[model samples]
Target chain A: MPEQNFPQGTDRRPFADGDGRGTRSDHQARPQGVTTVRRWSNWSLAALVVGVAGGTAALARTIPSHAASTTTTVVPTAGTTGAAAGTTGAAPASGTTGATTAPGASSAAPSAPKPIAVTSPSGVTTYVMPGTASGTAAGTPAGGVAGTGGTTYVARGDT
Target chain B: MTARTRTSAPALPDAWQDRGDGGPIGVAERPAIGTTARLAAWPAERLHDGAAAVDTVLDALDRQASRFRPDSELSQVQRSSGTVFLVSDGFAEVLDAALRAARWTGGLVDPTVGAALQALGYDRDFAAIDQDAPGAVPQGVPAPGWSVVALGGRLLERPAGVLLDLGATAKGLGADRAAAAAFRAAGGSGGVLVSLGGDLSVVGAPPRGGWPVAVVEDPDRADAPPSQVVRLGEGALATSSARCRTWRRGGRRLHHLVDPRTGDPAEGPWRTATVAARNCLTANAASTAVMVGGADGARWLEETGLPARLVSTDGSVHLFGGWPRSDEAPVDVSAGPSLSLAAASVGCRR
Candidate 1:
């Protein structure tokens, strides 16, 4: 029997998406909201401001009554919730007012996403979310494309 | 060799030792699971801790997954072959990785080749195998296919005669795990690189220029100079070749890479395939599958968009998916092995 070939690069996808149990359509359907939020989070502030403007204009035309009273809350973009909040301003139909902010942002700007230490099932590999330093010393800035550091040889074949 | 029956954490082997003096980048090397395990960490101070963490991971993997060890969890599963049995978490995790690789490559790099390998006279470790041994008549016992092995939660079920050899994916997974462990041990601040028999993975922040690696055709040949040196900032790099790990059977030279379809050593156009991926396991899987897929493998690799270097059996080189050009220019992140966009064009050609 021929083997089933999944979409390539599934290795880097989230555990849920890469588990081989879900189809591409299933992924698109299940993560629709989360995907939108993640996409918004990756946008630049300029692009986001333009998006907000366009969204507010659309809302004004669609729901004039709510638009007058609805204040567009510009949640600082950084954390997961911040990204989710960034999209809420455009969603007047949901009854979310500009006064409301992301759950943690109510006190102050949401802090940068903390690096969560994720260990593999076997306890062999651990992936620390990029950006933040938890219990250790201050984290150094991530580097760019690999450049010549020193010569380390990698041979063919599994030794 | 007595099989270690203890399922719990096994003691670190005495062979684990540091190599070379403390330098800008600390390096340690030790014998592990029939291969040499090497670890390099930035900020020399973290070397000791990183080495310790790597040692722990490698040892645990050997105890949990070594097929040659009669006491390993994999051996236990094989002993109870064909029945539904509960597997330890570590064993299950490794098996999951193996199965995933098989699925990704469409069984070209399957784990169910244990019986085929044994029939090819590769039942023992490479070091212990007699290269001169007479070959048995080729049984052409094709692998039962990875689909036969079922793993759910902790319960695994497979037919009685299906044996699994995790050799293809286990080491790559080990490198990933060891690198992660080493990075965590270093307080998750500096960078760590773990190479298990040349399949290497990097984690945490890299140095100013990323990790420099010299890609070689055959690591077994000490005199073999590097073909190319590429700096890897993130993820991992792996090479698979049919030129190494060979034994003579009935005067026929055979390699260890078995083609599941034919139950014979893969005889593809490419003798060696090297790929850079977001992780070591993915890289290893692609490289191995390329060796088995031959010319078609090159096409498959291009579709995946992971930077790959394929050396044909005639010694001609073919670069695909934005692999570093001969000019040695820095890899263009936009065009080079972008893991996010890799799936954009992947499909089954056959």
Candidate 2:
């Protein structure tokens, strides 16, 4: 009769008497129901934690070393030579390579790519190569003496 | 006719001068591309035609590569951040030369310093920049690095917020272009010299004794005699100086040459670098790299086997890679009239 008085599906048991103590059967049923619910919650929580940890570890393994590094790749155009493809790191080191203080004395010689002269239909000559040339044939003889009559000036500009 | 005395001023229309020796060479100059453009052509009659050709090349270059121009192709590329953009052949050629210079110089001469330049208050033309403007100097912003830019054929792609400034190579390319065009305009027979600002290029056949180039300390001081005079048989000559195109911000003087690594004006023992190479673009790149490379630049220049003249901050001159020495004594400003020529004709034959 007391059990029938309790609400259906309620885990909370009613007091058996004025002393506020649950009946013997009510107390026994409450502990088993609580343990069962707590065990299920713990298992679910543990599975979720394992899944999340596994995912994080997997993601950590997939990252590339150079993901943080900046890389530039330039495909050589029609007339360029030397390193058909080149890649420079994020921060290029200064004065370590490419050039030296003395001619023909560089320990780390820079690549010297000859420029290919391309003559357009409009008579414009474009140097298509990217690197310095071995020599040019357009100037006066290299040994020609300089004269005073027709001298031009080369200086820094405002641009 | 006796060669009329030439004044060290921008030689516009009426100012064209004939060589006092009455040689076939005539010199003409005009303001162009935010700087002065000078043309020296053989057969005095060809000077006008050469000038026209030079103008055409410079105008085209300005429209294609100027960072200060809102509608320039470079500016459009800047705005297209993170998008692939197709470039014209001319733009691609100039850009290729810039990248090659970057690669050849080990990134010492970078084109990606546009943002850094703007941050330094050089966002507009040098003449328009106010040195005394009130503002705090912004923190140095290292360039995005040239590596961030990708160019394949006419296609260019870069990350968001990357700005490209072709100031390093565009002028030289323009000079080279102008010289070739001028040479063609001159019937493609006689020699033609084109100097945009101080990037000088020559094509066809040089004069009897090569083009005599006066390497001066400061281009603005055109009236001051040069420290050295060199001869370029065919190639190109470019001079990069920290003393020119300078401004002040936050009480500190800044120059146009920004070290992409530091995002600030380059500071070095050498105040100026003048280089001669097989072409204008190469010459400009080497000279600029020398200025930006600072103390290490001299050695770098020597390695390239190109002739160079470097002026120290103290005004001392050092020459390398077979750069001819000046026979004439250095002019003293204190000694009046001796500096009348503006540039002393020191025979640097060979």
lDDT of 2 by residue, A1-159 (tens): 333344456455433444546655766677668768978999999999999999989878766435533222211112232221122231112223221121112232122111111110010111211111201122221111111111111222212
Candidate 1 residues B73-182, lDDT tens each?
67766766346665655665677777778887878888999899888888866666788776465666799999988777446666776898888888887788889888
True contacts kept of 2: 0.00
Candidate 1 predicts chain B with a TM-score of 0.89
TM-score (0 to 1) of chain B, per candidate? 0.89, 0.86
Off by more than 4 A, model 2: A1-159, B1-23, B328-350
Model 1 per-residue lDDT tens digits across residues A1-159: 223344464322333535777776655555555566666676867698998999999887889767654554322221222212113232222112223332212232111111111111110111111121111112321111111121111222211
DockQ of 2: 0.00
Q: What DockQ would candidate 1 receive versus the native complex?
A: 0.01
Fnat per candidate, as a fraction, reads: 0.00, 0.00
Q: Per-residue lDDT for B1-350 in model 2, tens only?
A: 11354343223243233332334566766556666667877665677677656655655665567676555567666765345666665666667777777877888888888889889887876666796766787667799788777666556555667777788787887887889888887787667778777788778665433455666666655577655443444677778888777778878888878889999888988888877776778878888888888877777887776766688898777766655443211111111111011111122101
Clashing pairs in 2: A100-B299, A100-B300, A101-B299, A139-B233, A139-B234, A140-B233, B3-B20
Task: Name the candidate that leads on lDDT.
Answer: 1
Q: Local error of candidate 1 at B140, Å?
A: 2.2
Residue B25, candidate 2: Cα error in Å is: 1.2
True contacts kept of 1: 0.00
